[model samples]
Target: MTLQTSLDDDAAWQAVLARDRHFDGRFVTGVLSTGIYCRPSCPARHPARANVRFFVDGAAARAAGLRACRRCLPDDVARDERAVLDAIAAIRGSDEPLALAALATQSGYSPAHFQRLFTRNTGLSPAAYARALRSERAHTALSAADRVTDAVYDAGYSGPSRFYAAMKGRTGMEPSVWRRGGEGMTIHWAVMPCSLGDLLVAVTAKGVCRLSFNETAADLAKRFPNATLHAATAGTSDMFNRALAGVEAPATAAQVPIDVRGTAFQELVWKALSAIPPGETRSYAQIAASIGRPKAVRAVGSACGANQVAVLIPCHRAMRTDGTLGGYAYGLDIKSALLDKERKA
Candidate 1:
């Protein structure tokens, strides 16, 4: 795909400041002042934004009369992302769980460093990623299988007891019920037009769980295909209406309660995001420091991206250290509008 198709200049600039590895190999940053091109996540000092240019690839950068920065070596796209990708490839490629030491050795880094590197890039430590992967595999197996025992074994769990215990926390339901795709519970959802766009609010007996934009009732049903989904009843409308109002005016959205799910670290990052007062913002680096994992800035970004509850969780409040608006799930136009609304409020 073309560079413009992959990411616009504004989005690419965010990657440059964050040193976001996801954008590595997708584009090269040409520093006009230095006459050099570098990887998006190059650690070298950043040139002035006006002096920076983006090229589709190394050839384009060279054609523009720029040499690659010796430090980041933009010409070698594969190696720029090799360290983290190698670790990820090894973990995903293996059926059985690979130990930290083994993965570290394969990546040519010491165990501790490898763990940090892996977590910084993927947002979860190696072990945590393994657990999540296992849980996902189990969930998929459960969804596709007719029998609970079949899923349990297929998920790689040694026994039913362990599998049920692990799945309980992940699905917040019994193994049998979860395997049935939340068959026992009723999910009420509504798609209401708000200032942003079509806002979909879905809730269970617990609380408001999902608040998404540009989605239809069908989208919500697909999220929990096993659950009995219906339009919001009068009893449930008030709670969700308030949430919709919150989306219209974020400064007033706080008191609305939400029931959401995420990993422990993601919860921490979400909490930090929620604490960012209506009009203000925080950098990904700052959020990482607040969570006591100062180096997990990328992971913090991942948590923001993974946020299911949009305005209530306030992922848009997080930005890059350079004070530019970073990536946003719902489009930067919406992100900018939300921030603008909050600041005015």
Candidate 2:
């Protein structure tokens, strides 16, 4: 059945009453009686179907002013262990520049065995996963105003020429041409101080784009060491004020402006990540398959690791096959908190 069918409202409500583990994070149930929303596996008393409302994400529910149930703590779950490890190993190894056969032999597994085990464990073969990771890192570096050569080298490529050629083959553009400033772009952002720590939102001209947490001027300096950041405090524009308000309350929606710069492959991966809804997840292999590169699982994981924007891009939603919480650029604790918050939301 299709994903939407799997989340049939009637069936999902029934699952909520039954506290089905499989339905965890699939959707949320808002109880009209208590004025709270909970996960399907919540231990709280089941509410009448007539009093329940379903939502795809906590932000939407919160936007409706419905408080999350304290008992279920739906928003506190993290990535499954299997998915985490698979994505992490894939990302870590992506920078290795070694041939797959030699790499497999060194790891004491046949290439075929390695491929199967990797896919089974992380949902993607090693090579594809590695490439995605490298591309993502390259993108993140480039977004911060780093030179193309610097981004390529930092992502473990030998040189800019090779990186440019590979990026062109994958995305049809030279990296330098993509780094235009936030010129005419308008981004929406939100800031929230929830269980996951402080949050920041940075939206693109098109939609919600960047989301970060517990960031300071120093942190921003570190992330974009070269860029100039402006603070908007006049409440003149809805976008700027929304972002500032999100920082104050931690869950409000805010729109701002963004200047994204990255290689074509990296851009593709980021776009795929942006499509993932909150509270749901996809494996690295699944992301690769979605992008029409079934063999690029490892690369997908790398791209996720390299993501600079946090929740807005939703890279944390990617996991390994065995249900493990994977490595996160911001740290495993933050990852765990973000996952838990969504699950419980």
Per-residue alpha-carbon lDDT of candidate 2 for residues 168-274, written as tens digits (9 for 90 to 100) = 54432356644543333333334556556776655443333345777654555455433344443334246545544433332332133334444445555766666
Q: Which 10-residue window in model 1 sums to the lowest lDDT?
A: 1-10
At residue 85, candidate 2 shows an lDDT of 46
Candidate 1 residue pairs that clash: none
For all candidates in order, the CA lDDT equals 0.79, 0.59
lDDT of 1 by residue, 1-345 (tens): 125534578978987997865466668998889899999989998889999888888888888898988997777655424766666667667878889999888877789977876765455678877777678778778779999999888888888998887766556567788766577777889989988888989987766778998988777777777777879889998888888989987866777877776665686688778877887787797677554455689999999998888999999999997679999988999999999999888
What lDDT score goes with residue 331 in model 2?
80
How close is each model in CA RMSD to the real structure?
Answer: 8.7, 15.6
- Global Cα lDDT for candidate 1: 0.79
Task: Supply candidate 2's per-residue lDDT for 171.
Answer: 32
- For model 2, the run of ten residues with the poorest summed lDDT: 246-255
Question: lDDT score of model 2?
Answer: 0.59
| Per-model TM values vs. the true structure | 0.58, 0.42
